[model samples]
Target: MERYFKRKTQPEILEPSPKSPKNNESSSKQTCVDSMEINSETLQYDPGLCTPILSYHPNVRDQVRRAYLQNKPCQPKTHAFPYTNFGTKPRRFNPAWFTQFPNWLEYSTSQDAAYCLCCYLFKPDIGDQSGGDTFVGVGFKNWKCKKKLEIHVGRPNSSHNSAWRNCEALLNQKQHIETVISKQTDQDRIDYRTRLGASVGVSRILLQQGLPFRGHDESENSLNQGNFLEILRWLRHSNEGIKAVTLENAPENLKLTSPDIQNDISSSISYEIISAITSDINDSLFSILVDESRDKSSKEQMAIVLRFVDKGHVIERFVGIEHVVDTKASSLKLAIDDFFSRHGLSISKLHGQGYDGVSNMQALVAVAKKNSEIGDLFTMVSSVVNIVVASSKRRDILREKHTHVVLEALENNELSSGQGFGDHKRFIAGIAKEGSRYCECNELGQYMQRMRESGWESLFDEVSSFCDKNRIKIPSMDDSFTSGERPNRKAHPITNVHRYRVDLFTDVIDKQLTELNDRFTEKNTKLLLCVACLSPINSFFAFDKEKLMRLAQFYPSDFSEHDLELLKEQLENYIWDMTSNSEFVDLKGISDLAQKMVGTKKDHTYPLVYLLLTLALILPVATASVERVFSAMNIVKNTLRNRMGDLWMNDCLVAYIEKDIFNSIEDEAIMQWFQNMKTRRGQLF
Candidate 1:
């Protein structure tokens, strides 16, 4: 590389120089001769006078000290000073200038010029009236005009003195700008973290409550700042640490309470809740309850719930809802399967399924009564109830007579009053017409036995007593049984009321019993019997190994012969173990047994037994909870929010129904989870 020197500009004269005076006196007045022409390349400026170096250097102190120590007196040989041409005259540097000052003067041997040592070493780059490259860049070597060098040093507080102070400060190195800014940056990061933490704390509360995040007006003048912003403001006002670094103190773009951030917090909270439930379920058997209905948009939606044993209690949790394209059974099944898979649930672990029936059976029963013979029987039973309990007078008389009968029966030891049978007026008004009460074969059989043992004579006497007391008619043995005409277009035979009693009442009761038995067939009977083996009450005697083995035979698709054998052995051992253990002895129901077993860590001991218990326990007659979810749906997805998305609806439902779990979550923990999801401007926790 070639090195080049910055060319210095020379002062220009307005006119040509005057011709040298011819007089000897004029020539004697000038201390130097006129200039002569010389090549510019041969002239060299002092290297030390080029510029004062201010860039960072570890050895700057040594370099400055060396320059000061090397300052020698410049009594250079007069002839050795190079002569350079400025214009027409030639000016030669006179180096015989050491007589004026001895301590601060510096002479460059190469340039044959003199410089001010103090100004060259310590002059600062800033400020006006600097050396202007004279004492520094181009040396001041005009020996005939020596006063210029004295003026270049200037006053004590001049730019030269300031540069001297800077040089002294630079020697310490610790006062550098980079080090100062680095410390400030760390403190800035800490303050930013504190500000972000306050914002995250507010987000958790709003999400857990299912409250809206944004307000209509969030400006400084607004009184209400919405849930997210308002809560943060409240936190700032109440907490000293948060107040110092939040709200206006925080950066605008990094408020950390945007809708996206709120959603992330809510989603993380939901994940934690599901994780807890998942752990509770573990690999245990569970049941499903599903109810499919249409939303406001007429789209089919299936609300699903899980019924399982958690700890010692049977808990039912709302899992989620699924949107189905169609209402067909296959479509619903596919939706359920997909929903389970997404949540890491297995249908193979399902022990039972509960469904909400499509329509109210009472309306269906009314419609069917017009065409079926069983309907005729039901109509007769309804008519009997109407006749007995129609008027206030007849109702009072029936109650009085019922009370008398009950007192007499009790006194004679013919009947014993129980909890539900204590009040005659509280009797089921339409007992014969209710299918549930009538199908209870044991109760029906007991009723039939009482009627037979008491005979029709007592019934007749009682009716005669009521009729005679009320001044009503007493039909004889040959009276017509009906006041209306029969189907055959002839006047029917007038069989006596006694014969009517034997015919109409007997046929109705017998037909009802027969129909009920037919409906409750061997399939249902065996199923109920098998389910009985899982009962934990009555000394757990219902847990018969033989009955359970027979029940396992029905589900060939699920249980093979080997499985059945294993189940039978498990059942025998379970019965013996439960009957012997003090913990199992007092268990009152299957749920109680399940809970006790889990508490004692005995569930794993008899996996098949507990599975059977789960199956039996979930065969509840009603899916009222599933129906209740639909009822809640009508309120949640009202006219205003009818168009809400499926995921949003599910989230709302979860938050609403499982509020206890949501409330149990700690505020700090929720904020921590939200912050972990992504990096944000603010620090939360």
Candidate 2:
């Protein structure tokens, strides 16, 4: 105890002096006095300043504990017993008995009583049981009942034994409460992640298939648990790893399959798919196709599609569906611009446009003058149809004449009796729409080739000989004919039937030749000719080096002096290799050439060439694919799902329309994506 004392200043002691009272004359009075004095080192009751064995602070209490453990309990000297007038004997504390239980038997000189040190420091609040009050509070001063100290420490499960166990644990220090709690938190985080993973896995499947995620009744007794929960339960049932760690096993509030959780997972999957599309587009030139329609609630939504070439394959992805207040062209253009800005796309990439109910070339009579051959043929056809079917009387005469001609031919065995022709008036009326029946550009191309091969003289001879054999009169060029009658004057007429013949025939041939010339503008034709030189078809006989160099001049913005020089060298090498290489022989078109370039690693070597090819391929000639998107929308967002949100609708359309790419995505990859999105309570994959 002395070795543990390290106070800076020595403690001072004081003794009260005794004095006789002035009125007192009794010197023979017997005074009750204490014979044994108490020491200051052992009597203070304040836990912070006194013997630190009782301190709650480990630093101070542990030091005192070690000092006390080094020595036995102290027992001071005592004097003769002070007798009380009560019938009981005053039992003074005995010092010799301290040797029997040296570690617990302690004497407090100030109290003139003995106490158990072990029980004083570690005694639990068991009230008066097991002599708790006797050993610690009003110290046990019963010297005659020395066996009471031994009785207090009774059997193996006694309070004293429990106190001793606490004392032992306090000194060990390894099993702290904080350390156990920290380990528990770590395990909780792991379990939360596992639970979240399982929830995300179930959500991705539902989103991918465009399936409904909820049910009308999702109670525990219901057999159908909805897509989200039922699938989660099935995952738990199939996998032993998460069976005991998810769903019902998880905390109520953290089941991880809540509606909010499902939506969050859906957003994550949609984000990943959008990210993939963005990566594929990656600054490439793209075209936009926009179409508008009224939803179930009559909200006008503009569905936008991106058409671009990705690795030589033409791909169109649904980027977003925006709600527009009106369907004006300017309003639509603004909406398109805003959508493009939101998705990090540039408006300059747009190359073509289409509308559902728009007619740009509506006046075919006006457009016919652009090509004289088409104009002449149109004028003749219009005149003939008007003259033959202008009135009911003329129509009846033409019908009767045709019937007589057919009967005569049938009687001579020159025509089949079962031959029939439908009414011509209805056919002319049905060709009302612009570019409806007569605008076949491929057919025009074929007709131009025939005229060039057979010459105009041969065509005229065939028509003239047919009319002569049918005994139809040919109008003489010198005959006169009335053109029209004026309101107040006689109509003027002209006679040159041969002049009309020469003019009509020559006009048809000249216009056919002009169409071939007017097919593409100078710059466009040069570009097309250059592009054609890269085509792998026509037996690869179209690859010309001169035209390709001319094509480079059109894009002065992209091609520089150095680029042109490099392109020339590369083109020569490319054409030489393509003509001789057996692998190139199988490619039949520019599309196949572009695809082969990617597969054969030529795209990396000839990047610019591949880029040009991709641009040409992606340049939209029609909006047919965009129209298909609207058609898909009609099916997906029908009356039943009319109230679906814009974001949800876009997600469903992306999954439904681009199913080919969606199907290629792995389920495990989607599951992992959901797991990494946020912290949860269970594992998925």
Candidate 3:
């Protein structure tokens, strides 16, 4: 009996050589391939179809045995058992035998015979008892031999009884050594999870609020042991079960309140958020917006944002912030390449790119400086601002004088009092004027052209009125203008009017008009016109079927000829549907229209039109998402936290800027990921 229970010596499994033939006779010699192929899903349940138990690889033999045991024995009691002629007498299997030996009796309909379930799975190779092979391999169909069944269940220590005992022990998992040991380890894992969850919760709160995690002194005796530790302590006190297993009560090595642990938790959370964003993108067409800025430590940091349409709604996600050695184009390209590779993204899918508009303005200003008069005017205005703000006393005096002027204006009713009454009101009024004037790109270009042709007189008059009110002398229009730098007598003379109106004012306006023409070329102007046709304001008043069809032609790669034909029809129906639907009546912009289309499921109804809308939304309008990341970087890596590493700063910034994504993640997920990052002193799962 003891020998039957001894462990068997099995051959080592080896990998099959690649050079081996698929139909080679030696293929049977490879055990690893066979064992890898066997699993619960592939296990045979029909008793007659099962292979010999010892023929299987020893490594997976137990798995196969458990599968068979879990499924129990296959008993086809309803089967019509056939009989063989024995001494001129015909007989068949009796269903009453199943009741007599309920645990081990199994009938295979394929062979029309009876078999033992335990002996098939646990029968030994060395010791052979009478009729053992008959029950295991050859079917026992002797209907005349009623006493053989009792002989098979012979003495208590017989081969059949021993195999039955082994089957029982295998089925009762509570008696296994590993299960008994895991009882204690399971408690340890529960406690570890509780402790780690508390730590992650604290980290999330600090990350969301953009607060620093560490203090000047983190010693236990100190009053402030940093936000991470102090917040964790407060959480511990709030819950009794957590208090009993966290902080001072936890194992010193597994407290998970160290700065490194906090960083790991924060990084895991950021990666999870980025993973979700990429998943939402799902390898579809997307646009990237990039911007770079210097942190408080003077390190050049580049931020990236991904813009894509998801489920008929436009989404912009802040993906990462990388520390580059320089802000040159080449360095930025390399940084972007690395970011794309790490996030499983491809530049081929990028349909658009966005950068700071300040670069274009800076180039325009540089070009405008070519005129000496215009250059001198800009220098004067810049110098004034610099001089006033450079001195604290001067800034205070300027503020006081501005306050007195505003008060006098208010007393005289020159300024109105109400909500948004001062600078905000003026800003809104200016925007209203511009909005009314420049309804489209072509209009803006024409407006600039008109400004160049006739705007100088009004500008000059306003300047003269300001000078007279301040009691400053206005130079005569006929007086000869001279350079301020020690008058060059060799140069040609010019009147004050030409200097102020032509050299300075006219040149400035002409440069602006040239920039406008350069930016809004004929092709770009046409594209903008097509895009404006989809505006949802006032019940999509700008809707134009022909213009939208032209827009579809621009993206030939996305819309085929067949798609275009379908889109034309979709557009005709779409306009009618949107104009009649109250859900889209008061939409403010394209973005609102997009969301409403999704809410009403119109995107699915008019998929081709929705595709055009999605493509329109993918166009990069601004790099504001990237700019927000830089703003978050300043707060996360301020002077006090200047020493924070690049990776740490990036992690904190991602969590802070995309708090919406960060908040959606569960603490258990973050804790599980952190645990798997490295081998810990305690198990988490």
Candidate 4:
């Protein structure tokens, strides 16, 4: 590991408290208390001390009344003698003072002097703070009253306010403490770099340790690995630079010397993200979807999606792309399987599969067959449904009626001789001819033309699913050999790789579907299968297939329409009519092999499923859905283009989808469980 460390430093002591032992400690002192006694040292006579001494004097009603009757001015009590000295010599009549004592004390401007009158009138008694009494109800459900408690406190004054004001300084103290902590950490990191003999920041940590900055890249930063390029990026968004604590705002990339290195960093980041995401997909069965489209440069790209089983299927996320050699099922399957192997996933775990084209449909069904629960395939039931329902949703009443007719026919036991005879043929022919005419419309016309395939789409999906359940294949590679050794190696359709590609190209995109570019992300060639993909053109496949193939991966034989050539000829023909003659169809797809880019090279035709997928990718649905994903990526890895290693970015990207898992998690409970984690090792933690 590249060593990096930081040290912690202790904080400094603060200035001492302001409390003092002596009142006259300061040279500029104001008030000094000497004595209240009637002696030469008496301070009441002094201007400063007289007011306070008078303020503390007790009230004498008789003396005040006597003074009032005598019409005497207010004066100090020096002349008045106590009874022992002179007061008992028959001069005790003092009823005039109370009548002469005027109104309350006046407000004064002086800060130091106090009004004796106001002090007597307003001074609060310390013992008077408690309230008189508090009442409490008593006795079980009865209404008896009882005195319970009393509480009282005086409001804040000058002395109390001094203590309360200390809070104003706390923020500064907290900031200082934080700064000290940060400095200590930086120091430790510096020490770590010195020990490791590596550079630190723009300046070397070793240099701070009294060693010279002595690396070749120390001078030329293309070689320098410290806070260089990061600084440049910071400069790009100048204000955010100082505040950004995120890895994105690091300044090293800013100073990095070369563009190629910058690009390498970028690519490295994306790769790391993709790698991390792929790894998460390895643990369980997942659905796969794919779309095919060509770039402006005419490169064929396969956008893949892996629908993972998170906490809930409704919130499941998709997006796992691979550039394959061709549109052939084998090549597409190879790309998918290779990716799975890279991510450490097993093919045996694959359960469900979906596709927009015939290639993906076949491949996914094949993979589903590997699962015991899938019973040798995902029944073609759903594919058949999507075709009809999707067509039905478009307000195609006759097609909907036809679907119900089949359901109705199945409800009734019959030979189903609904074709061939002239009377019946005329009835069917009129419907077929009517559909052919409706196919001329801009929208539902094409769907009308391939009504049968659209109807079969749902059937193929459902049937395959039914078979995959309770059935599975025994792969050839397993050491256990309980059965006969007469192996059928050629059973895999992938064996004829070239033929698969040719077949796919011919069937898929023979019509208007090839126009599915730059429309939407799900529709986009680069991101079609991504969650944000969208397009104006329709599509037919989204892949869900196993990456690896093994022999004996089957139960007792089950035969469907596919085993015989009759079904293939019928479907292939319908697919051709639907695509080749549709409006907005590309003619170059028909004549030029160069225009048909496949995995590694160009081709003229592909399998029926590819045709279906080509249609699906070009479909106008869910373009915005895929945009949401790429939008997240753009937000995550934007133009300041802060780079994350593939693993970390993948974690972030997947986090958007992992929301379902997170939602189901009782985080508070988990946190409570982990609250003691730090104490697990008795201080090591």
Best by TM-score: 3
What is each predicted model's overall lDDT from 0 to 1?
A: 0.58, 0.59, 0.74, 0.31
lDDT (Cα, tens digit) per residue for candidate 2, span 1-685: 6699854321111111122111122211212222222211122331111231322233334334432332234433232224323246655556567567755676544355666666656676676766855666566666777788889888978887887676565444334453344444656666766776677667657665667777667899999978777888888888876777787798886687776566656655555566577668876767666778777768888877787887777677777677788989998976775454334354445554544422222232354455555567778988999888879999999899988988888999977755544435455433322112112333345566676556566766787788897888766657864334443355345565534444455554565555545653566545555666666775578778787777667667457899988888888778777778777886656767877888888888877677667756654443345666666766667776677766666666666667666666665565555544333333332
Best by lDDT: 3
**Candidate 3 C-alpha error for residue 40, in Å:** 35
Candidate 3: tens digits of C-alpha lDDT, residues 380-447: 99999999989999999999998997788789887666624677878765553333211345665677
Give Cα distance to truth, residue 475, candidate 4, Å: 66
Runs in model 4 lying further than 4 Å from the true structure: 1-254, 275-282, 315-320, 357-685
RMSD of 3: 18.0
- Give the lowest summed-lDDT range of ten residues in model 4: 133-142
Please list the residue runs of candidate 3 whose C-alpha ends up more than 4 Å from where it truly belongs after superposition.
1-184, 328-330, 346-348, 418-444, 478-493, 519-522, 537-544, 576-587
* lDDT, candidate 4, at 349: 42
lDDT of 1 by residue, 250-276 (tens): 667755566665566555566556546
lDDT per residue for candidate 4 within 572-653, as digits (tens), equals 5534443453442432221111123233121123333232223222222222233344445455444443433332333344
CA deviation > 4 Å runs, candidate 1: 1-236, 242-249, 294-299, 357-525, 553-563, 580-583, 599-607, 618-621, 664-685
